[model samples]
Target: MTSVWIMLVKKSRAILGFAAISIVAASCGTNAPQDTWQPKGPNSKIIDDLQRPVFAVAGIIGLIVAVAVIYTLIKYRDRGQPIPEQTHGKPALEITLTIIPALILAVVAVFTFGAIFKLAKTDDTEMIINVTGQQWWWEYDYPTQNEFGITQPIISSGQLVMPVGTKVLLRETSRDVIHSYWIPALNGKRDAVPGRVQTLRLEADAPGIYAGQCTEFCGLSHANMRMEAVALSKADFAKWVANQQAAYVAPAKDSLAQQGEEVFLNQCVRCHQVNGLMRADGTPAIAAPDENVWSGSAPNLTHLMSRNTFAGASFDLLSKQCRDEVWNAPSDVVGTKYLAGVTEECLNQKDLRSWLRNAPAMLPMYANATQLKATGGKYRGMPYLALTEDDISKLVAYLLTLK
Candidate 1:
């Protein structure tokens, strides 16, 4: 029995030693760019500050308690000693321990409330953006931009764009089940619940791409719901807005792109809009998302290539080299690099073709017409359109000209 006890202790020590080594190794990489601990904005910095001391205190208390328990077990073991008195219910010791934890919690509550109030401040906010969460993507709408001298609202999805050094307010809600909006470099996660609005403040110290994902478990394609916050220079941001708001030009006559436009009218126009596509009688063509989509919305593809990513940002629109040129660029140059958009040679054809071929196969989606009867005829993703090779090639051509 004694030998068995010693063997068990040795195995326990070995397991504990391996765990400690693994934890130390994990802690070594503090320089990860997307790490929540490495705050890039004021709000995140405040959270970082608030958590550092809290974690330190927790670590110290845990270490102290563990040491005391270990010491008691080693020094007061029941090897040959007489049974101690029934001192478990000693009022003084119990009171001391309980009061200590209570006081610590009180102190923590004060600091936590202070940080919460601080992070919630939107009085100094200069701009407001509406963020809507659907099953697997985010929609960002700038309701008003008078300061930028823009009267018309701007709506975009897949990526959220902001100007550096601006405290922008994000009013968030959902169209379906609850989803969490999180961009680790900007601020903490905020839940987007249907019928209720939640607000989160986001600011970036410099121009760069900060990747984020829907932290809340949503549905079939939840893991594919990724997003990015692109912080641009003020001058470059104005340029982008101007470009996005520009008029959409029709494809030239007798061109492949023009032929693709015809294919789109017959196939893609049901759930998408080209803004000014003329019908046979020269009437304006409008996308009827309410009739076809579950969320009563679809991603507006007018300026699809202006952003680097597409399809809920799970896939890149540009080639690996060009994408790296934009995301990995220096902060000062990131804006200019991003505004370049996707060029003909830099387009990622493989993924885009595969996505067009079978969207539901690429990502799990509740898009089957028969399967979505439970949603009251609403769909959670783009259904498979069964495009022919010729149709897909033409669609790709037309989509590329969207930039």
Candidate 2:
């Protein structure tokens, strides 16, 4: 029995040592995009400030308690010694410990409340954007703000774009299950519950892309429900807005892209929307996703190539090298690189083709005919589109012109 106990203790120590080492190693990592410790905005800085001292106090208290417990165990071990007389309690020691923790908690509460109030301040908001979450993607809609030159509503998906150094308030809500909107460098996570609008304040100190994820456990592709916040300078943001609000240009006559437009009208228009698209009868080509999609909507792909990523941002539209060029570019040049969009040479054809060939094979979704019945014949995700290779080529060509 003693041998077994000794072996168990050894194994426990080994496991603890491994866990400690792993945690320390993880903390020392660089280029960790979602690292909460690295604050890039005022709101996140508030959180970082509160966390640093709280961690310090907690670490110190934990170390002292651990040391005291270890000392008592060593001093009172039953090693052929008679049991010592037990006392009822140490009133003074108990009172001291209780008072110390209470005082610490009081101080922490004061700062914590202050930070919360600061984060919740909306009176100073300079801009507002509506964020809506669904099964595996996020949609951003910028309301008309005349002061900012936004004359009409602009809808985009896959990434949220905002001006740097601006107090942008995001009014978030979900269409289906609850989801969380988070950009670790910008602010804390805010839950997007169905039928309830939640607000989160976000500001970026510089122009760059900050990655985020749905902290809430959603559905089938919950892990793949990622998001990105792109911060651009005010001037650059204006340019982007103009581009987004610009009239959609039709494909050139008799081009392969024109053929792709026909294919899109025949096959893809049911779920996707391309603003200003005209039908053969000269009527507007509007999508009817509410009837076909479980979430009642799909991403508006009016300017699809303007975004570097697609498919809930789980896949990149650009090849690795081109993507790196945009992601790693200097702050001042990042916007230019991003605005360049996906060129023919930089397009990631393999993944796009694979996705078009069979979407279910690429990502887990309740998209099969049998499974879709539960959604009332509505797809929870993009269903498999058995497009011929030639059709896919034309579609890709047409999509690139969206910019």
Candidate 3:
């Protein structure tokens, strides 16, 4: 009997050791872009600071409890002995346990309250950007700010761009189902509720990319609803604003890209907007997503190539080499590499072509005619356009010229 008990205890410890090793290994992921511990801004730092000590306290308490339980079980083992101490009441012991926990909690509450207020402070905001969440993507609209040379509104999707070291206030709201905006490196999660506007403060300590995702389970493809924050130097951000506001340069007359533009007007203009596109009748081209999509909007692809990712940042626009060149570039040159945009030589033709071929096939979305019943003859996502091979080629060409 003693040998059997020893064997069981050894096996239990071995299993527990394996689990502990596995957990530690998993937590040490080398490419954890969404790592909460690796905070890059003051707001996130506050969260990280609070979390570390709280986690320590919890771990210590858990360890103490486990040790006490094990010690008590061993020291009071039956061992063929008679039961002892029928009475259970112990006022002094109960009181000590209660007071100790209360004191610990009181200390934690003081720091937690201070951190909440610090994170909520927004009186010193240097910029304001409106962020709207839809079914599976985030849309950012930079309101005109004379200080940044942004004379006109700039709309972008998938990627939120801001200047490094500047306090950016995001006015968040949802267009359809409830969603959440979170960039772990910059700040905490903030829900984007419909009919109500919420604000989240964000600031990046350096120029780089930070990964994020919609935390709330809004609908299908919630896991794919990802976003990225790109922090650029003030000068680079000014240049980006200028590029976004610059007049759209028409594709060369009668070229392949021009033909692509024609195809775009015939097919994509219904839902996608390409700023500065003019109709043959000299009318400004506009998109009417409200009539087509239930969400009432689609990603604005005016400067498509300027961004590295597309389709809710779920697909890469640049090839691996090109993407690495931009993402891994030094802080000073990252802006220049990003501004270069997608060129023919650097485009990730596989994903881009596949996306243009059939959007619903690549990403789960309610684009089928049958699925439209719930949305009142409207799409919850992009429907198949059924473009020919020639059409896809032309469309790709035209989209590349957006930047």
lDDT, candidate 1, 13-77, per-residue tens: 66557656654654456555557777889999999898878876876686576557555655565
lDDT comparing candidate 1 with the true structure: 0.84
lDDT of 3 by residue, 1-403 (tens): 4565566557556655755675465446565888877899999999989997897788668657755755566566668887776998899999999999999999999999999999999899999999999988999999999999989999999899999999999999999999999999999999999999999999998888899999999888898999999999998888888888988999998888999999999989998998889998999999999999999999998989888899878888999999888888888898888778889999999999888899999999888867577788898888888989899999999988888
Query: What TM-score does prediction 3 earn?
Result: 0.95
Write the residue-wise lDDT of candidate 2 on 196-302 in tens digits. Answer: 99999999999999999999999889998999999998999989999999998999999999999999999889989899999989999999999888898988999
Q: TM-score for all predictions?
A: 0.93, 0.94, 0.95
Q: After superposition, how far is residue 131 of candidate 3 from its true place, in Å?
A: 0.4
Give the better candidate number (1 or 2) by TM-score. 2
Clashing pairs in 3: none
Residue 249 error, candidate 1, Å: 2.0
Worst ten in a row by lDDT for model 2: 1-10
Return whichever of 1 and 3 wins on lDDT: 3
